[model samples]
Target chain A: MKELTIGIDIGGTNTKYGIVDRDGNVVFQGSISTAEYEEFRDYFNGLAIALRKATESIPFAHKIIGVGVGAANGNYYKGTIERATNLKWKGIIPLADMFKEEFGIPAIITNDANAAAVGEMVYGAAKGMKDFVVITLGTGLGSGFVCNGILLNGKHGIAGEVGHTSVNPAGRFCNCGKRGCLETYVSATGIKRTVYKLLADHLEPSELRGISFDNLTTKMITESAVRGDVVALAAFEYTGRILGMKLAETVVHTDPEAIFLFGGLSLAGDLIFKPTIKHMEANLMPLFRGKVKVLPSGLQNQAAPIIGASSLVWNYLDNNKTQLQEEVY
Target chain B: MKELTIGIDIGGTNTKYGIVDRDGNVVFQGSISTAEYEEFRDYFNGLAIALRKATESIPFAHKIIGVGVGAANGNYYKGTIERATNLKWKGIIPLADMFKEEFGIPAIITNDANAAAVGEMVYGAAKGMKDFVVITLGTGLGSGFVCNGILLNGKHGIAGEVGHTSVNPAGRFCNCGKRGCLETYVSATGIKRTVYKLLADHLEPSELRGISFDNLTTKMITESAVRGDVVALAAFEYTGRILGMKLAETVVHTDPEAIFLFGGLSLAGDLIFKPTIKHMEANLMPLFRGKVKVLPSGLQNQAAPIIGASSLVWNYLDNNKTQLQEEVY
Candidate 1:
């Protein structure tokens, strides 16, 4: 019998859903605007309707195992969405229970970063590797670390928050109310702040002059660097160096085989990769100096999250064969 | 039928050995000086002879299954001793191969830190935990991280070098050439430095004042603190606070169930533990606040290394049943 699973990626803006096969091929996918706080149950009902309509054309024998939801503050163990600062939801929401009620199959939930790490491991760049770290660079820095072929959930499911670690105690204020975090130097907003600092300190000339903080974006800096803008390019180098140094410290603890970069700002290939690798090498201890590799995510854009969420289902099916068989029997 | 394994803890100055059962019981134990590097083979031969003499008085058919050796700079995968700075050996030594050749049994070698971590998991404070980190605070700081019930040996078998990580870019010059290592503030030498800094800055009459750097050990400071010396107590508090903050970063990354502190500095108990736990809770990210526990090693004194090295043999024997069956068949 053909086996199928549902993968849900709930971002701050849109919630993307896909029906995926065992091979990670998405058969059907759709997107919907995330409901404002008041319409939580009604919004899920709408999602279920859309999903049923999309999968109606598939063969009847193919069985959908369950749904796997990936949200910003989702918890795998709890199957609920924790408080997300940007989301309209002010309290915990039973997302997995609602999904199960709609689909009549077991549901799995994981945080966005954890889902992404699993996605990279099962279908993306980290295939066949036992230890690796996935870093997502967007508004803030998010990381997922896999060690010994297992996703580390820590004791309270808060492991792999690499961004909050203090790299430079006096460096910059972080969104987490900490000082000198790696995210302060490496994230998209972090790069912009660096550009602003450079503009203030040096006598350099480029396109980023006199621009308001809101007007500046990571894309603008990348475009400027591509056009031979010295300040913009230096900003990227500076960002990558600090990130690499932080990575060097992390490697000392986790000792992953490779680190995979994903999400928005990671799109600046050599702009970030070159300097990050250089600084990581310089900062590493003698034992781990030259062995760790940095790679890019194979599942680009929306596919990354969908594939990551699907991987949870695939992994669950594989590891829980006896229980699944017992249920079927 | 009964089974036994020999666990060896090779130090720069002494070599400790024990025959252990599956339940972590030491059947027999002995120690010898390892000062002469060139005569390692001779030393082991004599050591084995002594062990055999001890076992002759026992009542069992004592078949040694394997030998697990823990040294300063050992690698598990390649089973090689990569030039330990403290030991006289200046080149790579295939110590496991030598042991296997002499004993006619499978042998494994790993760094002392990794061994200690394995020890903690199997028979020490971290028992029953799926994830934990063991920090050994001796002359230098050594770390061993366990994730999902397995040791994390990064890409080149050189992960978990947490001591060398820089907390302050301008803090202190580390032996590894890095500035502001965590060890620079938490180790015995680190405490001495803290004392001098406090004395120089505060002009306080400390029992530690006017003492030579070599003479002022962590023991003396702990003793002074026990006697109500303000400066000594302040030094412990300072060191613990720094260690706590560093551990907070560690918790965010690996998310171990608990962190176990072993070795000489941990002997101070409340002097280090009280302040370390208090400060760790203070600096933790809101998500991790009051979640992770920090505690001391259950394996006290010389038993730590013996239990740790024996854990390797037990783990290997448990996992290598196919090989064992093949040999028996």
Candidate 2:
């Protein structure tokens, strides 16, 4: 029978899951509304049933070997999600253990960014690369750094919080109660904030001036910028500049070969990529100048989170096999 | 017979060398004036003669198994010192190859900060700890980071340049042509700059006001601060605050278990340590607030460099031995 792993990505509103083979092919895929279940137990029960139904629908012969999950504030060592502000669950949830109990298989969990990093390493842009970084630019900026082929989870399994790294001490206030966090200026929400700031700062004529703060979206900003709106274009430029500078600081820490940009904000193409690359290069040290590449995620955008989550199982199994071989020898 | 490693620390002004055993003991020590030699060849000749003399003076049974060097801008991968502004040498110098040719032994070279980190891991503060950072504060700030017991050299063997990470975009002009680098506000020179800035900003009556820019020293500031000089005390506070904030940012990226402070400036004890620790704790994320320790180096101030350099050989041998055992089994 063909071996397979179940990969699940838990977001605030929805949960995505897929049965994936070693080659990163999804045999069966499904989704469930996470918000519909108010209690943790109810959510787990629904997820378990959904996973079973999805597995039963797969046509090919397969043995489910393991399960992997990706979520906000997921702790790899503890197999729990702790105090995720966006999630409906209020406290620590033993989601990995719940998955194992339901599927009777080995299971692992890590933060979404780390899952993306592992996915990139296993089957996406970072394949065969020992050192690299993956930056997810969705609602906030999240990062996963890999060095010497091992993911840098640090001591607490929460090492890659690049978004919280302060860029400006006196700049914008972040949700974390800090000033000038990289996330406050670089994410999808950050771009919207920047657009409003530009609208207020610049007196130049622009199409986005009439848009209310509550109604304005990153998509609207991107569209306006593409249509030659000066304020919208400037917002992207400012966002990219901040992101690039922050990345330059990151380079001094781990010295990755490449930094891959992923998620919603990254899809804006050259609007974000061009200025980010330019500012990153401009801020790099003399030894690092022109040495590192800034690229986009190679994984299919829609499937990236699930694929990334699934890679954890493959990684865990590979490590265990190596350890077992070492012990036997 | 005791196995010995030749450890060399090449500084801009002087070169320190010692014969060290696996136990991290210095059997014999000596130094040579780096500035006395006009050419690279001349310096190498002097170093070789000094090393031979130092070895002969050791009245014990020993076999010299390997050699390790720590220098400014040293490259572990290339075994060369490249573009070291502080050094008299203009371009790349194959110092490791030269050492090998002179001693007929395996030789390796890495930058000074990395050397200090290895030193701490093998014999000093980070012994038995897998995840930690060593910040060496002298004329400038230098850092070496270890994750999972392996040093983070990155792709170019020049990662962990924490000193160059910008704390302020428009704060101060750095020698690297960058604006507002952490080193510009936290190092020995940085403290002096801060004192000058404070003197200019606040009209506080103090001894430091009389001292000219060229005449001021970190020692003078420390002595003045200890004697209850307001301007001098404020300088340390400002420096510590900046250092702490930068370290807090570093934690988000690497999530180190502890950060060890080393070098001449660290000797000020509570003057720098108190404020630094206070600010570091205040700025840390909720998850990492009390988890990370900021402490002083465990190595003796004088012997740390040589011991750290010697550790490279031991680490290399241990890794190779493990690899060999795996292959044989």
What are the fnat scores of the candidates, in the order listed?
0.76, 0.70
lDDT of 1 at B186: 87
Docking class of 1: medium
Interface RMSD after interface superposition, each candidate = 1.4, 1.0
Q: Pick the candidate with the highest TM-score.
A: 2
**Collision pairs in model 2:** none
DockQ of each: 0.72, 0.75
lDDT string, candidate 1, B19-113, tens digits = 88888998888888888646656776777786677556555765777788888778888888887755776678888777667667778788888
Estimate, for each residue in A44-83, the C-alpha lDDT of model 2 and write its tens digit: 9898899989889766566777788989888888899988
Chain B TM-score for all candidates, comma-separated? 0.90, 0.93
Candidate 2 at residue A211, lDDT? 85
Q: Model 1 chain B — which ten-residue stretch has the worst lDDT?
A: B320-329
Model 1: residue A181 alpha-carbon error in angstroms: 2.8
lDDT of all the models against the reference? 0.82, 0.87
lDDT tens digits, residues A1-329, model 1? 79888888887778888999988899888888885525677677778888898779679998888787778767776888877644677688888778767777878888778889988888888889888899988777888888778887776666788888876667798766667888888888899999999998999897889578999998899999999999999999999998888898888887788888887778989999999999998888666777899888777776768778988888777778877555433
Q: Which ranges of candidate 1 are over 4 A from the true structure? A: A35-39, A325-329, B36-57, B200-202, B324-329
